[model samples]
Target: QQQVKQSPQSLIVQKGGISIINCAYENTAFDYFPWYQQFPGKGPALLIAIRPDVSEKKEGRFTISFNKSAKQFSLHIMDSQPGDSATYFCAAITSGGSYIPTFGRGTSLIVHP
Candidate 1:
């Protein structure tokens, strides 16, 4: 079973707005974070990630922010668009164990243009 919990099962954002998704992991052993975005009829792709050493990581308009002490992390989409609509999953990978990813329930994001 995955130890991560995500919130806001679904989200609706206006075009050019900001879309945010949050997740919390229970295992302190987890050190790697990966955020996946999946489109219909497609597999999830690595969207972005934040390392435990950094509080935040930003790439283009996408950003990943985390609180190592809180064991919480989040994904942020800036200037959201209709094309950005998809199901987002937050995952954590253990540093010493199997190195396998344990995913959260996922959040569905709908961006209206």
Candidate 2:
């Protein structure tokens, strides 16, 4: 129970399209669910997150839908754009136990012109 796996080596979304990526985690003890967005060589930034207690959470242009029973989570990007082209990663953390995160390989999203 210590890994988060994501797929889709690359994604192509038209402008204003909705981009979706899925992730599965093994650790049932994970309480904090966070999705990070990284551009090129930069560090990943926390884009959105949800706790196991919640079914789903939404941010401005991003959304995180969590499945407690399935131990899975996904990130949705709305209004895709060329500017939004970046790598996305889904991660999980434990507050009471450890803050260290298990990150998914990453999903590279490309919003076409």
Candidate 3:
């Protein structure tokens, strides 16, 4: 079984600061990297993702930077706000494999106004 390790069990950031969460995976077969965000009483939602082909990807205030050689990826939230406060999880999935995602433990983000 592949293992995904995420850093920083929790995080606190200012309303306009940048929040970064990192994750590392053991499987080289993993092809997709997606970051999921979940708020209270809600299922995880895809925030952003990046493939090994791309080094970086950006969507709105969220960005995913991937390092294939390092087998790691990170999520960068720019201009983070209190509304963005949620538990973030990193996941990896392989289309040819089971297609089941291996997720990180999750990081709770608290943005202070």
Candidate 4:
């Protein structure tokens, strides 16, 4: 079975509001968790990431919270803007192994002005 699952397949947020996406993984082997953001007609880019050792990581308006015991993680976008609208994916990879990442289904976010 796939190790990762994501929820709220799609989301809509008013401008200046916050957007949240959640993901959970079943494999204990996964040590690296990353979130990717993609715009139309472009490849996905790394947004934020957290290691099993860290409880949370934040940069700019993006934040990632990780729960090692629960094997779950979440992404929060603060002050979302229309330009921030994009498809987001949460992925897990095993450290010191084949670095191939298992990606979640993806969350489509729309920020309306």
Candidate 5:
């Protein structure tokens, strides 16, 4: 089974600082890396993603850095704000396999003003 594990179950950041989170996986068959952000009472939204064929992918303030050999990945948030505070989850799944993903426990980010 594909398993992704996340750390620091929670985090706190200043309104203008950067927030970083890490994740590790154990399945070599997994080929997709996606990060999701979720607000209270809402569903998670795809923040960014990277494939094993690529080293990294960035979308605005959100970036996903992938490591194929190490079987690890990380998410970086720049210029974080109160509005950016929410739960972040890292997930993995095979590209052509079932779309359902194996997710990390979750990290609650709280940006204080």
Candidate 6:
């Protein structure tokens, strides 16, 4: 039950619009959730994250809304720009010793100008 399922394998949005991606996990043991953004030919970098203790977290134009009871989370990008076009991944990891994250299949977002 360590799997994380992401939806809308691909998304397209106009500039100044909002882009949203959703993810769900089956493992309640996962206590740490992080999102990553990656551009072509570059490694993924940490974008934003949220723990079960918090219902939501926001950083700049990016926001993560989490539902501990539903075991689900989503990322919302406001005023999406072309520069925001990239592959996003949602991951979860267990607490305590192991820090290895279980990643979703990833969602590719493209913002049109």
Clashing pairs in 2: none
Measured with C-alpha atoms, the lDDT of residue 85 in candidate 5 is 91
- Tell how far residue 32 is off in model 1, in angstroms: 0.1
True-vs-predicted CA distance for residue 112, candidate 4, Å:
0.6
Candidate 4's C-alpha runs over 4 A off are none
Q: Candidate 1, which ten residues in sequence have the lowest lDDT sum?
A: 93-102
| Candidate 4, residue 68: lDDT | 89
Model 4, range 30-67, lDDT digits (tens) per residue?
Answer: 99999999999999999988998989999999999999
Candidate 6 local lDDT, 1-113, one digit each (tens)? 54999988999999999999999999889999999999999999999999999999999999999999999999999999999999999999997958888999999999999
Candidate 3 local lDDT, 34-105, one digit each (tens): 899999999999888888999999999999999999999999999999999999999999978899999999
Each candidate's TM vs. the true structure?
Answer: 0.96, 0.93, 0.96, 0.97, 0.94, 0.96
Of 2 and 5, the candidate ahead on lDDT is 5
Q: Candidate 3: misplaced stretches above 4 Å? A: none
TM-score of 3: 0.96
Between candidates 2 and 3, name the one with more favorable TM-score. 3
lDDT: which is higher, 3 or 4?
4
lDDT of 5: 0.91
| CA lDDT of every candidate | 0.94, 0.89, 0.94, 0.95, 0.91, 0.95
Clashing pairs in 3: none
Which stretches in model 1 have alpha-carbon errors above 4 Å? none
In terms of TM-score, which candidate is strongest? 4
Tell me how far the alpha carbon of residue 17 in candidate 2 is from the true structure, in angstroms, after superposition: 0.9
**In model 5, which regions exceed 4 Å deviation?**
none
10 residues in a row with least lDDT, candidate 3: 1-10
Q: Compared with the true structure, what per-residue lDDT tens digits does model 1 show for residues 1-113?
A: 56999988999999999999999999999989999999999999999876799999999989999999999999999999999999999999986789999999999999999
Q: Among all windows of ten consecutive residues in candidate 4, which has the lowest summed lDDT? A: 1-10
Clashing pairs in 6: none
